[model samples]
Target: MGFMSGEELVVTLAPVAVYWVYAGIYEALLQHTTVLDRYRLHSRRDEETKNIASRKDVVRGVLLQQAIQVAISVAVLKLEGRGAAAAAGDGRAAQPEPFLVAAARFGVAMLVLDAWQYFMHRLMHSVPCMYRRFHSWHHRVAAPYAYAAQYGHPVDGVLTETLSGAAAYVASGMTPRAAAAFFAFATVKGVDDHCGVAAPWNPIQAAFRNNAAYHDVHHQRGGGRRNFSQPFFVVWDRLLGTHAPYALRQRDGGGLEVRAFKPDPTR
Candidate 1:
């Protein structure tokens, strides 16, 4: 009933923690060394010079966004009666849901999140004022790195991330533990999408079609108006004819690069 504790605290903080740890590794390996250079989608030089914002600014922005996310998550837990339920001590042992049921719920949550983000992300690009004032901040990192994944205006983060995540959590009816896992997975996926690596051997990238290469296209100059889906499926972009096809080409400078093809006019 008071400040978040136990499961509630874990649920609210796990995703933020995962984001930092995962992004930190990418920062160290990609930004500070050339060990992963061959797997990179953009050259390290491009990441250093092409990105509009400094690493310090990106870190500050992501920290602020994560703070907002944590606050919203705690508020959601309270609204869902999780805090009070924990306080009242429900003495019964909690039974985990069946694996099939949990998987179904996770699928539903992923769809809901993809739908919410796809629509909202496209809308932000469509509106002149919204694009100029809010979403443009995210676009500042033309060649994105892992830590820049959540760098955006605060209001943009709330609408696109916090609200969408909360919607997914509520709609899927997942347990707090399941929600913690889901949120943590989503955090990792987002970081990977911006990681600037198209490592084919990476299971997460191979498993989801919407990987770093796909997202890298969206960040490019000509591809901005397409491939608006994020972190999961590309169903919306495909169905809506906004999907830009791309090929992963080896850069002349010894890394990989995404060469996005123009969307089909007939579609």
Candidate 2:
């Protein structure tokens, strides 16, 4: 328990709270943008404004999934003999300052976690049984909103958080405070990916679209066997020869409909 007092705990959590609040606002705006006439996404919940009112639905699902994840994380930390209960009354224990050491750890952990996530994400899709059982729910929401990001089955949610959390834990130099920041940042990023504005200039979104369009295109086409990279770079896909040749193909007048990669059963 690095939380020395109620005030200290508030200070530790304040940034994460603010980040999520901003995500909530950004998610609302982005979801609206996604369903706008420009994107040709049909509105499902509005008639007067020709807009969808999916914000509440998406928020409810995300919150529910996150609540369950938090509960499971608490249980896991308790079982591992860590957390406030373990650290309580242990003045000898060294706790990193939340603002400094923890913040740095968060940054490093995110970078490493992003790379780890990229590869593991591809495995989830490559394994057919696992994809059907554990990953299909995520793909079900083809026309996704921000809240739709977390609208997955329980096992899927657990596996997703566990992988990211384990990556954060393994990433060197992480303090508990930094771990909190990583969790907060990861949550926001997940929600934002579903916010669908195609803002190519936005750094994070740009990286995601260029490197990880497999999952996004999967939503559009029900399946795609290309562009399976994630997070920061498409190096893995490029090396594997599975990278979607979107840019080259587009220049040659081909479209982004990923079904082109499908193998012909009749062949």
Candidate 1's residue-wise lDDT over 1-267, tens digit each? 456657888888899899989999988987679888898887767877888889889999999999999998988888987445645765431557789999999999999999999999999999999999999999999998898999999999999999999999999988788889999999999999999888878899999999999999999997779999987999889898999989988889799888999887666
How does candidate 1 fare on TM-score?
Answer: 0.95
Off by over 4 Å in 1: 86-93
Q: lDDT values of the candidates?
A: 0.89, 0.52
TM-score per candidate: 0.95, 0.64
lDDT of 2: 0.52
User: Which residue pairs clash within candidate 1?
Assistant: none
- Error (Å) of candidate 2 at residue 123 is 3.1
Write one digit per residue (lDDT tens) for candidate 2, span 90-206: 452344455765566766776676566656667778889878887776666665554565676567666655555665555544544445555665666665565543443557665
In model 2, what lDDT does residue 151 have?
Answer: 70
